[model samples]
Target: MTQKKRIVIKIGSSSLTSLHGEISRRKLKRIAEEVVELKEEGHEVLLVSSGAVAAGYRKLGCVERPTALTEKQAAASIGQGLLMEAYSEYFLSHGYVASQILITRTDFSEEKRYKNARNTLKILLDRGIIPIVNENDTVTIDRLKFGDNDTLSAKVAGLVDADQLIILSDIDGLYDSDPRKNPNAELVRDVKEITPEIEASAGDPGSAAGTGGMKSKIEAFKITMASGIHAFLGKAGVRGLLLDAANGTASGTYFTPAEKTLDSRKQWIAFNSGPEGTVTVDQNAKNVLTAHTGELQAEHVISVSGRFKNGAVVRLKDENEEEIGLGIINYSSEQLQHFRELDEEAKAIVDSEGLVCRIDVPLPATI
Candidate 1:
């Protein structure tokens, strides 16, 4: 028997809820059935579901999306409970357990916290429970907001190192023209790359109920693909679409993974977290690092900025301020400045040759 593939399936608001803003029980049951089948097939699955605000819209007597942030927050708070309850009851009948995990952008931005989350989810997967993730809209601040579930789904894929991510939307797949307006629009089955031209073809958000338009989905695709993970977009209401897509069926638009494997730490450094500061290096230094995979040395650095301390990860930039890489600083900014003042030969003596330089190591006074 083949090993089961790990997958992440994200269902947007438009598909999971009705236009009048209620959870579509029929749709939910069909999705639940497919997911249970996948689980029985030995596949590990994670769900990124949207519809909290939509489910709450009717409950608040609002006919549309709330304009006020507080209203939206209240709706989400109310709807999240209903959404999870429906999920739990449905999955329970199928003999499968479901767990709800609400996350903010900040959760994936802190390395230690990101690792903790990864471990927690791994334990759930080990126990044969499906982890259903969502954005914590009720308490998450502006900066922590994921903006939409598309980005949240991508981040979940990266964190779990999922083999594929399936984003089920209203449309069947991407098109050269807006299918609603253009009768001759061609359906693009395979999208190995998301160029700017293809993005221009995606006109706008289909509905006001959803936060992210096609543009946001494209951005999410870029994130998932960079981590060497496959991303697919398909029709949410289609039965067995998630399973078919995961099995490499021609059901939707497929974004192929990159050739190189993006390691877990590199994934965190590149996209998971925000950098504390930046280190500027010359062209020679850039060439050595980018082309030859060289280790950083004090002689190659031009300057360091921001309030980054020793052992903190910082972004590396060239003279033009273009990001080149990220790495841990061997010295603090003040210590780096002292090293910069010395000549190349003198600096080599201190940094490379281990000469007795009067440097203030922050820990303790040792003769």
Candidate 2:
């Protein structure tokens, strides 16, 4: 790493588990050592790891991984402390401090709390402390869950405006076809854009211990790419993997960011602060917003669905009920239903100057 960079590494449960599907100390030590080396080289590192369930299930006196939600949560409660203890011990031996941050979706949904998390992480990173992040599975409900840690890692990468995100898995890289099914599957070493074919080829979790598979990784890349953060997906436990990925020479699939990126404010609006409702607009407004060169006006809004207060993020849809993008609406659902035209005095908005309706964030392209 020639220039100092902020990097986030996501390690899945499969990478940290043994053949019997339990936490492996050797794998954890290897990851911690590489991270310490990265820190010594003047680079900031944040880890988003998933192994609580794997580490705690056996301790819960189970023969294998538990499928029930309550059982999973119980396992996490037992494993989180053990996982952190190991991480702290390894990092402390290397003369470094490791802090733990366990968060749920609500932390990112509320703007105030989101900014606070960002600020806290910024302070830790500045002080040369590596913040290890994980989803607070003990109390998280399915409705507010992030689905998988892969999604959590991508969101965190955007939260800190990381320069790059490295996702470590058991697979070496993405293949055109399922390697297990097809004997001659070709590894896709570089990817500039995620095409429809690529999305279609993404399959379910390959390992019994993992929750998110190739599909989840692809979805995670969409968030990073939209935020203008480069990302790499590669096999874990490879020697010098972190350094090589940062230097752009790793044996993995690299994802290039979009030319136009969303800033911190926009990223929060787009990826976090989950939409409260949908605002339907005319075809013309939808076209302009997705094209990256347009502003939304109250006159263009045809209708509003769902109850949302003013200053809330809402999904922007078209006449046909197709989602175009998302933005912070100035008027509440009740207010928009009452009147169509927003006068200048009310400050409907102008290119997000008065903060009325800002909808420049683009969604992923569909086939």
Candidate 3:
């Protein structure tokens, strides 16, 4: 019997839209069928779908994709409902219920909301319902946008502790060079790390209907790898591709990290909770934090930057101005500043449990 695992599947806009740039029912049907198969085989699946603006713009009377933010948001407002309707109809026909989740960058940035999302998704998966996630594009401003669903999928995968993340795009896999520019470029089969060479080879977005390109996909993989979730990237609409990916037999670029997986709190601090401020520590404090010897005391801090509330994620920097790591500050920036004037015995600050180090690793761009 195959082991039951929670999987997060990301479908790109190019995959869901037709040549004329509208939501294709045939494509949606195929995806629904594949997900049904996975459910029958005893795996939990959550989908991150991108095509809101692509599916809705033409219906909004635009000949091409809207360039203005409000126009695009208007299109998304119309399309999101239609998209969910199609998914719900298709999944229900196969005896599975589909649920919609509209997410924002702020949802993940706040600790309580982040955990709430996880719990909700967990409940859906546990009850055998498929959760379809999309960015809350209609209400989100440009600054608060997730940028693309690729990054959103990775964050969602990490949020639910998914066993695998399958990203289906127009391209089959990562190439050694930009295939459009170089005909001799070869597909990379397995990636242990997102090295500089790999980053250099990734090109811009390939489709007019899609916002995320290979570069964004690579960024997504960085988050998955760091979270220790295996990820696969391949062409959409391939026969049995979803099942093949779950079984580790898919023809695509596979990403697996060499390091141990991060815990849930660490995953949040590393990828989601946006650091509210910076705190520079002395050499002794840095040494203690890095070595896991003790907590960061107020007397050990040289300076604090930015205003932040207590329990906010803050960047920890060293005396030389290099970032050491991030930690949940036990005191507000104002409190820390006041405590600087207090004696050492009265200045206990961030607890060790709230601290996370290993700042040298390449974190996801969304962080």
Candidate 4:
């Protein structure tokens, strides 16, 4: 028997829509059936699907996908419902229940809200219900948006600590070069580390229906791999594609996870939380922070910039003003400055666990 796994499937707009920009029922049904089979096989599944704009633009009386932000948001309001209805209908036919989860980037930025979202997903997945996730476009401003479903899916996979993330796109896999222009471009089937060369090979989006291109896909993989989750990227609608992906038999790009993964708290601090202030440390301070050997002493803090409350995430920079890492600061900006004038015994110490280094994350530490 195959071992049960938790999988996050990200279906792109192009994967679920016709070339004319309308959602295709035939394609949706096929995808739903595959998801049902995965569930029957005891694999827990979550879907971060992108099709709201494509499905609703026509209903909004737009001859094509809208370019204005308000128009796009309006289209999403209409399409989100229709997309869920189709998913629920198909899943219900198979005796499975499907639920909708709409989110904006703001939801993840706040720690309490982030945890609440995770807990909710835990309940749904525990009860054998399939959760359909998407960006809440109707109210999301550009500044607070996740940008694309590709990145959102990765963050969701990390949030749930899923066993694998399967991203279905118009393209089958990453290529060594631009296949459209290079007749001999080769598909990269297995990727353990994303090198500069691999990054250079990635290009712009190929489908007019989708927002993310190969670049965003690579960025998504970085998030998943950092969280110790394996991932697959492939063309959607291939027969048994989801199953093959879960079984590790798919003909597409595969990403291997790092040996060590970030813990829940650090994962959030590293990927989700936004930094509010900046701290500049001397070389000695940088060394101590990176070594994970001790707490950050007040004497080492050369300067603090920006006003932030204590316990906020702060960007740490070195004497030369190069960014070194991020940390949950122990002191407010004013407090940090005030402590510099205090006696050695009265100084505040930022604990080792609060710091996150730039080169690689330290083991369970905060800077």
Number of backbone-clashing residue pairs for each candidate, in the order shown: 0, 0, 0, 6
- Candidate topping TM-score: 4
lDDT of 3 by residue, 184-290 (tens): 98999999988999998889999999999999999999889888899999999998999999998989999996486677888888888788999898998888777
TM agreement with the true structure for every prediction:
0.89, 0.92, 0.93, 0.94
Q: Rank by TM-score, descending?
A: 4, 3, 2, 1
Cα lDDT tens digits for candidate 1, 34-94: 8988898899999999999888867877877887888888899989999999999999998
Candidate lDDT values, in order: 0.80, 0.88, 0.87, 0.87
Give one digit per residue, the lDDT tens place, for model 4 in 230-271.
Answer: 999999989999999999999899999877677777778878
Candidate 4 accuracy as TM-score: 0.94
lDDT string for model 2 (216-312, tens) is 9999998898889999999999999998898888898999998878889988988888889988889888777887675776667788889999999
Q: Superposing all C-alpha atoms, what RMSD in Å does each candidate have to the true structure? A: 6.5, 3.3, 3.0, 3.2
Lowest summed lDDT window (length 10), candidate 2: 347-356
**Any idea what lDDT model 2 has?**
0.88
List the candidate 4 regions with Cα displacement exceeding 4 Å.
Answer: 341-367
What stretches of model 3 exceed 4 Å from their correct place?
342-367
